[model samples]
Target: MLKSLVVMAVSFLLSTAAVAERLKDISTVAGVRSNQLVGYGLVVGLDGTGDKTTFTSATFRNMLNNFGVAIPPNIDPSSKNIAAVAIHTDLPPFAKPGQVIDVTVSTLGDAKSLRGGSLIMSPLKGADGQIYAVAQGNLVVSGFGVEGADGSRLSLNVPSVGRIPGGATVERTVPNAFAQGDSLVLNLNHPDFTTVRRVSETINSLLGPNMAKAVDATSVRVRAPRDPSQRVSFLSVLENLEVQPAQEVAKVIINSRTGTIIIGQNVRVSPVAITHGGMTVAINENIDVNQPNPLAQGETVITPRTGIEVDEGSGHMFEFAPGASLQEIVESVNQVGAAPGDLMAILEALRQAGALKAELVVI
Candidate 1:
């Protein structure tokens, strides 16, 4: 039979003709990226589901003092319908003043929920300690929770966090440094030496000899005109050039939280023997009442008893032929009626034995 193999990252793999993509799709120009902005703010106008912590009261009084309101020093402002929240958003590159951006608000106090809350004016700051945007708007919460007096609570989604669509206004702009150097650098999103070499050769072939050079696995330097107007046109042409990148490394990713295993098509296995078994122990509790002998002047007492049962399964053993493909491995394992839990253990054992020819990543 023919060798069975699959390309890892099939979802991202394109058709043969479509594999040639715009250079911009795989790489970004150096000095062109987004910055993170964060702010601390207060959320108001909630429907009785708000923070009652002492810090919340102090924050309320501080806000009042800033607005020229004087209160008795001992008066603890116990506002029941206001909450403190942390606001955060990404400031896109070349963002100009007056541009709007969406923001996320997360509760910082004992607020029950952030539903139907409006944020107060908060100045968003960048890493350089400069205020770049101002965020203020009504929060949109898609989840809610309800609790009964008996402490029975049902939650649909996260209620302590919310989002505001286009709520922040940019106050400043982050300058771009694209036109400074005679040569521009391209940074690949997925760094590969083969891809870098291909990109360099493609550019040199079209523009001229030595027009591009692979400085590192991730960075490629290309000669270009230094004039601002000409540089823009040069990049426009450079990003449009189609090039094929290298295939990704074969990997098997497992999510322990969800017990999901994803095996890449390129994944292979050497000859290996695997045994899948299960052992279970169950403990049951029972309560019994002991009564004093008739009129013996003794109180009745309750006694507890536990019963434990153990079942050790003799697992099935299977062997994989050398160079077996991922599909075949899964099929063989399934034919033996091995459960997901058992499959996880078998894969790990194969990896430890060096029979698995792929990276095993657990998350």
Candidate 2:
């Protein structure tokens, strides 16, 4: 009874571990991706906050003409509740006819907000200029507001941009050569030679030898059944097979515009000393009026005096041992009281001095 219970516990643990992660999260099958779709249309029913551009009038007129409502050419109707907008959505791989996809609508004209507005019928097209889907729906806008009487407005989220869930209907399918070859290639999102070899080995171990080959660091070619139905099943099995990927390379990414710094876990710093300090200056001005003593005739005079004071800040010093890791780097910098800006300068200096053992990218 004791042995049977131990075997049952082990089996349960193994069964639960088999479905750790879905293959779609780690690897992407080539030719299986989403294509961007875009279109131009108008959003109507605004509360007197629509665009006043002449192009909006022309577009409105064109729409009327299509509906057999002919207006005199001399008259231009400018409605304050209609805005010209652009629509965008993604066409997923293997999308079929009559399937709906979500879409985003953004103002192309000077519309204050698109809240409570409805998008008109618009044909979404691909890069080849062929209409693939049509989008039309009421917009769900968030956080758009009009300013005060002086045109000073405060908003948290953009109201001029909105989204419609399941708005566009797919009219045609995009062509893909997914089933043209006997083998399929799996591309890793991040290229690593070690990861590629491991992926190929794992697949071969399951589906027999020579079933998968690493073409390069970024791509792994796998043989599959010639029949399309069997190929789908084979992929379904291969994707679910778990394989551990290699560690990420050491690197640092900096956002110069935002003053943000991101240091990788694998980054290392050699032995170095860092010193940071701050300085502040203060200025003061004083004016004095001199009047003749009671009766002494003397013209009133004013004298101005200026005083300047400077405070030189004290700096703290910190040292790192050879090959210190990320946590050590952060603690070392913080120990010296370095601000974000000061830390940025120190990181660049370290990279230039060749003491950093990782790639430093300033974006």
Candidate 3:
């Protein structure tokens, strides 16, 4: 069933029909993106699967000090219920104070699992070393493990990493140039000269001439109203405008390990003939025992016999007409009953011979 689904997905990817897509689906506004914030924190309430590292102990002491509880310099707490962790979350664009976002917690020490653990309040900082949010919540772990007394263990998924939805409360805002600039830049998800030109032309046609211009293959600069409110409304309209994107480049993707082949719709094969076959060799070994006569010396000898056989598989030859389409190529290969590996070899050979009109990518 899984194999059929994979084949179906590949078939879908082979489609060549061009469709009109919304501008928002193909491009993003410049300087409008998520900010990554990370922090080092601790997770507690583990079931004897905590870190034993010295740094974990030190962090525990520091956390206690913040709570007005001091321990002796030489005294060390060896608790098995605490584990150090690292927290990270993305601060979305235009996020305000008190807004909550999801956070991912990963074990930073030698902890076995983070299941049933609670994360302590930790400050998440951006690249500029400024705190942006605070995270504190119970971890939601989807993976766990169990160990036997004889050292055998069973595990499912990853138990050391977890997520806490709406765990971090935003405390700071990352400023952007959305309202300060007179022009906005649209960056294409897939850079192409034709696509950018079409985007600029589409915008110009909607508004007036000289309203949008293509800066390069990946960007389209557009003039906009200076007022923030007008800019927001203007962008809302522009994002929904539909335009047909340029067709993708012709290419072939091959998964060598899984024996999966993906041929793009634009892939074509020049006039070529291919032959595929296989050879097999078999060997057999036999042992024969020779016993002396009843009254003769009591000694037995053994002799070995060997046999070998060879078979040459039936080679099938197929031909591709000039500028063969994807369906024709598939039919030709299927008629020859060629396996994935054989088909990959045939494609590579065609590429080497300059007959395959597409870039062959093996992964």
Q: Backbone collision count in every prediction?
A: 0, 0, 0
Cα-lDDT of candidate 3: 0.91
lDDT per residue for candidate 3 within 290-322, as digits (tens), equals 999989878898999898988898988888999
* lDDT scores of the candidates, listed in order: 0.87, 0.85, 0.91
Q: What is residue 280's positional error in candidate 3, in angstroms? A: 3.1
The better candidate by TM-score, 1 or 3, is 3
Find the candidate with the highest TM-score and give its number. 3
**TM-score for each model:** 0.83, 0.89, 0.93
Best candidate (score: lDDT): 3
**Per-residue lDDT value at 91 in model 3:** 98
Put down candidate 2 lDDT per residue, 1-363, tens digits, no spaces: 323332353355345533434455678999888999999999999998899899899999999999999989899877989999999999999999999999999998999899999999999999999999999999999767868998788876898899999999999999886787889989988899988898888888888899899999999999877787888888889888877766668888878887767776678999998777888899999999988886787789999989999888897778889999776777677666666678789999999989999999999
At residue 118, candidate 3 shows an lDDT of 95
Q: Over all chains combined, what TM-score does candidate 1 have? A: 0.83
